[model samples]
Target: MMYHHLSDAMLDDYLRDVPVPVGLVARLKQTAVPNDAELDELLRSPPMPDGLVDRLQAAIQDEILDESLRQTKVPEKLLVRLRTIPRARRRSAWRRFAVAASLLVVLFSAYCGSLSALLAAMRPKQNRDTTLTIIELYVDPTHSSLLTMSEADPTTIRFAPPTSAEMAELPIELARLDLTPALGPAGHLLQEVRRGAPLTEDVFLMRRNTLGSPQTNDQALPELSHVRRRQIAGVDLPLAPGYDRAFFLKSGIHPPVFPAAGQPTEAIQVPLVTRTDSVDLTRRLLLEGRTPSPSDIRVEDYIAAVRYGLQASNDQSLVLYATAGPSIFGRQPHHMLHLGVKAPRVQTATSTHMSIVVDVSASMRGDDRIGAVHRAFEIVLRHLGPNDSLSFVAVNHEIVRQVDFLPASGAAQLASMIRDLDPSGGDNLAKGFQAAMSLAFEAEVAAGSARHVVLITDGQAAIGDRDAARMRDLVATGETFSIRSTFLQLDRLISAETVPSSTGLEHASAVSPRQLPWRLVTLATGQSPVVARQARLQVAFNPQAVLAYRLFGRGPTAVTGLADVGVETDLHSGEEASALFELWLRPNGTEDVGWAEVHWTDPATGSPLTTERMSIGRSDIAVSDDETLWPLRAVAIVSEVGQRLSGIGDFELLNGRRFSQRKKPAGWKDVLEQAVGVHPSAGEQSDFQQMVDLIRQLEELALRGPK
Candidate 1:
């Protein structure tokens, strides 16, 4: 079994033919072979060319299959079936794969193109620039009642016929008194009389004589001769003797002053009088002729007669005090009503549910107006806290709920929507209010939240109910729902022509045409027109050199430099500032009499600051009954007169003649006398007495001629 040195071919043939003894195999098993380093190196080396091993394996497999076939016969039918199978089908599969790959490539290219187009479509479109104009109508709810008149009927009277002799003498009597110098060119003798200047004795005598007699040169006036007196208010009363002269004098006379055919007459300057002044003069003349009945005066006339004193409340609120006096026009009792409103202060911690309803109607399309609204929204958003909830409703002909009631997280989305908004269509304030109310109701349901709806519009409701009463009702509806509503009317200060040239792509430009070089664009556009000057500069300077500046009635101690300081620096919340200027006495010198002012913008609210002025001569202060109360009294007078003349009050009298002889209520002088008799406080009594004395002095001055 372990034959040594046997030839390799002989040992292989002997092992194949006969099995080796078990003892010999065991001995071979136990024997250890030496390590063949050369053989390991040969194995690690490349056996042959890359495909040589595969080729060798295929050849070996074929040889083995051939040997097996030689040793064992295969079925002829199976071998024939295997050989008949088609091999070309593999080429078909390859072709299908190539077609699928080409299809995928085409689909991918199309997909990429479609995706690019979609992205482009999502972008904002650029449109042409549109110019817009806005007009705001502010209806004060508190003052609406003033638009109506009382139900009481006015008294009427009739005069008796006059004789022919009186008519004949009227012309001669009128000619004796020349009214040219007193009436000036405008025929406003009452205005001169109201100025309270002393009149000349001759002028008084002329007026007395002209009003006392109806005959002159032994002839009766024509007015007396043609006596056709009509009854008023169904009351027929006999005329007093010589009533023609009184009537003629009370009713102003117009005498023609003709110019030569070729000669030009010089223009005459006439002093302007406000409606209040006219009413006052008319009332005074009626009193001088006869007493007015109680029903003839109006509530507004009564209110206008009192002088309201200004006082600041403890909480920095304003308190207006009006001295109660009898009606100046009729016999109406007077009472005082004081109202105070709390100022809005910033509260960062409070949770607010705010619904902003903006009018994006055609009227608000103006860049300045709408732009102001946008800025206001920004300011409001900035003031909102994290706990605050917001809802935005934009209205034109239709209502758009741009943002629903949600937390401050939606602020960014709301702002984006606002920027994209462009004014179009008509205003539907009612629909806007409804949408806002819905939001407010939603906000109300949330616990611990205060609801408010801010309506920012041009105040024109064209597509909806434009009636003021209906609008007020809508506001009342909001109140019922427990939602507080505030209205802001956007008023544009600068005209469209004032704006710089605007290209269609102004929106894309870095700066807007509406923007001035020095300040933000919206500051000047959004604020009240009165503060335009201040919004731009943040400061205003006085151009004139005045001896003194006084904020009258506020006292010299209230502000520093009562006389020297001209510029006003403190202006907040768009409040207006007015000052009385003391100028150097320039008797006959010709110089500009106006005061100069500069205004600037407020950084906090983006509103404008305003400075106003009034010139006061030394004589005015000297002639005033109470110098300390002069400014307040003057302000009260202006306010009262303005209120009455605004047409919201005393509608019936607005169109009446300046010197109507119609009877009116007793003068405020009588009312003051009664009030004084009531034994008011010493201060009140003094003020009342001073007012009475002032009125008497005015009457005396009117009767007498100017010195």
Candidate 2:
């Protein structure tokens, strides 16, 4: 029988009183002992700190208790042996110190491995690893109240000296980074941060969720969580940027207070915009193992992102759908009214002239923004026919590349052009738009071919035409040539006036990269035609039937008797636009709840076509579980989740001095069980499910103090 050979260390152990096999005995003869010179050199080294072995062993013991450490695949037997090493060896001081130093190195390497695992697990599955520079602020030990910023990755980050306001408390000096040439315009972002702008929440959360220190559990937040933020101040202390009202208001300016009893009729001007960014932002935050900021939750966007089973119209008119159900939300029982409208489908067989302008600026480098633009055009290219013409333009500081009116037959060439896009330099989106419009007019449209310019950008126009007036002018020029402009906003924040006065039926939609292909398909193929231009919905609640009412998604800019505000919204074929209202119903009142009106115009004649109205009745209200009431139930479910995260519309009796918990709303479990949920079964359904689950998990995590 053959015996396995032992290692040198094991052989040393075996030779000390233990019997060794013949195979190990032969290997032991080859092993060498420390020479006289090596022994002297080891002795000459400086003495180790007193209790160094004990401290390291204690640290390892505490590290084992961390959640990250518990989840790691470290060998239990090895850890147990390491813990007992000091007691097992009755050795000299220098030898114990040497052993402990070696163990410290091993522990550090293990920690790095665990940290990489933790970050990888938090990143989205579809995204590649992105390099990010994190700037951390820690309280100085000598001066507990003072904070200091650490040096970030030198290539990507830079800091100017603190401004007078920033140094009010202490200098808080930070090391200035040397920004490389490749960083380009990104270097300005650090100045924005130093000026008290809110830093990206991802950076903040990434640091907050990293592995705990091995030496101590002295974290900034209260309680003793294994995942702790060492850079944060105390519990009541504000963030480093000093969050103000403007910072919170960026989420959205709260709508005017709900109309009081005996008030005039309320009307909301539904703007022509698609609000999907907030939903995308909230989901991305949750996917990264971070609780979304309350301000990031916009209930209106959640309502707009999903479908409500609205069907297409047969004629050139509006199809109105309305439903009423008793709501389970709020301090008092209320009624939920769901108002929906769908525009009739228009078949356009004419060839389309398409112009695609892509932003290849430095700010668009992260988050795969350029990749999304590429994918959008790929979808558009697939939808076009041989006769259809395509124009591709890329912009950064100046026009990077422009291929004018490439026939669909040359799609391979266009694809190659788009794939070569690389993000760099400044953003001059206005120049790109001008070039695209010039190309569109230079080529005469064949008889009835449609003209469309699709501008894909993150909306950070740094160099030129940053104001609304210039963009409005560009939109007007596009209107002259009957060119429809569609701005695909790819950022988390959507400005209210991306293309200010879009009278020429210009459109804007906030969408994620994953959603870009489908959105582009709808635009490129005219799958959903615009049946209504400058359309608006007016819902007047009966004062006798309802004591107070609040409109979800949009709040009335002003409330007067009637016709107070004028807003234009575009209604598309096979697309559903819905508004949810929470009405405080008056007991012992009339049966009539409210009435809604849909006003729209003809797409060709620019004349008002017809008005549609539906009268809501209180007597026909059903419970949420009713199969026929799914549309209204969906509005309730999505609105409630948004309110729970945002704390908006919740009554605060004590005005922020005290807090209390009321009964939670019901039917979430039932909603999940229903076949029809927030998104369809294709790919979005799974994402919606994951988002809901993450919300629940985050709520539980909040309740369980620090773990």
Q: Which candidate leads in TM-score?
A: 2
TM-score of 2: 0.41
The residue-by-residue lDDT of candidate 2 on 1-707, one tens digit each, is 22257777876776797665778865776466666888899898979889999999999988878867776555546889878856464669999899999999999999999999999999976523233333446833333232333233223322233332342222333578888675444466566667887544446534655333212222222212122111110011112221122322343333222333443334334443334455655544443455556644556667766566667666667777888777655564556778777665444467888887888877676555775676457546756766778888998888999998898788768876776777777777778888887887876678867888878877555433354557668788878878887887784333234453222224666665645655665656666445688777767766677655555644222222113334566665445577777666667879987777877788777898656567888776664444336567666766666666665654322221122235444324443333244334322332244445645655555555324
Instruction: List candidate 1 stretches off by more than 4 Å.
Output: 1-345, 444-448, 463-473, 493-707
Worst window of 10 by summed lDDT in candidate 1: 266-275
Q: Report every candidate's CA lDDT.
A: 0.39, 0.59
RMSD of 2: 36.2
lDDT of 1 at 566: 27
Query: Judged by lDDT, which candidate is best?
Result: 2
**Model 2 poorest ten-residue lDDT run:** 229-238
